[model samples]
Target chain A: EAGVVQSPRYKIIEKKQPVAFWCNPISGHNTLYWYRQNLGQGPELLIRYENEEAVDDSQLPKDRFSAERLKGVDSTLKIQPAELGDSAVYLCASSQETGWGRGELFFGEGSRLTVL
Target chain B: GESVGLHLPTLSVQEGDNSIINCAYSNSASDYFIWYKQESGKGPQFIIDIRSNMDKRQGQRVTVLLNKTVKHLSLQIAATQPGDSAVYFCAETKSSNTGKLIFGQGTTLQVKP
Candidate 1:
């Protein structure tokens, strides 16, 4: 089966500009996640979706970041007025909803963003 | 804020040697842990996983040991190969359902061939 797929494997933007990333989860997967990995840091959770409803987005920078998972099959993450510090690799992952504890998570080749 | 971090930033090992990677987590509520391997420009790929209920789980040439008491986790790779070179990360989930994982800082493994 095809793994999770993401668009624009890389992106470059000036500080204060806006950018968006897209993700398509594996077929039949019910859970989707968005994570940001800064240089030398772990991937931090930005949001999570179970179907079309966002179950966890507290970590997302609401002031400038927003996400959507319409139809529960795909997701999009956006950042406006991007900061230099915001430059990082954004990863999209998916898993079957049977429960993350049992099944493994699959990730896409992340979208690397560079802010100039 | 809870976090997961690796003890080493990098690990160098001989091609035939075993490699062990360690991680420390702060969330006591976390009940599941996973180890992932990521090549440069690629995303993290699952290597192995263990639940809080079990202390050790083994998979194809890899083993994951979880210590809920100390909030420590370890991944051991047997007979490491050059292809094993990558950044390794340990991730934890507080619950079994959300599937939202909190990843570690990651350890770069360099297999000396």
Candidate 2:
């Protein structure tokens, strides 16, 4: 069927403005992840959710970044008062792994944010 | 469109030739390793994966060779085509919190037609 879907394919905002990105994962996928990819760098994990519980979020910047995957299907990542350094592609991915298994991750086109 | 591997290492190959891209992972205890292909302005697509217990895995037209002794991984593309040109990434994953998937910087594959 359809793959993961993300909203606002591209966003541009001035520094210190608030920005938000949304994601809808594949159907029947139980795990979701949020990652940030900087220019010329690989995507880094920001938060991971299994169902509705956040299993990993150590990489997320709590001071300015926050994420929630309510209902275990769609997720939203928010950055308040965005900084110049916060400009990056926010990617959302989903997997079908259970328990301690690591399955293939299906990713979306990503929300590209540019902060000036 | 924005390119993904601006400062990353590159591998240039001719059409219909064999191509090999290598990566050195960080964790030796990682449960498994995976390969992803990402094109310009697109998300990464899964290519193949190999578990720690396995040294090799083959896909449609690709092969993944894992050398755990040196914590190295390689992806071999047979009869490489221009469509195969993209950024390749290798990631290591663990089951625990400390084992989040660590993605490599990615290698740009330039296939000359």
**Largest TM-score belongs to which candidate?**
2
DockQ of each: 0.61, 0.50
User: What ranges in model 2 sit over 4 Å off?
Assistant: A98-102, B1-8, B95-99
Per-prediction TM-score to the true structure, in the order listed: 0.93, 0.93
| Position B86, candidate 1: lDDT | 93
Residue A112 shift from truth in candidate 2, angstroms: 0.7
* Stretches of model 1 off by over 4 angstroms after superposition: A98-103, B1-6
Give model 1's DockQ, 2 decimals.
0.61
What is candidate 2's local distance difference test score?
0.87
Candidate 1: give its CA RMSD in angstroms.
3.5
Residue lDDT tens for model 1, B41-104: 8888888878788999999989888888889998889999999999999988855553767788
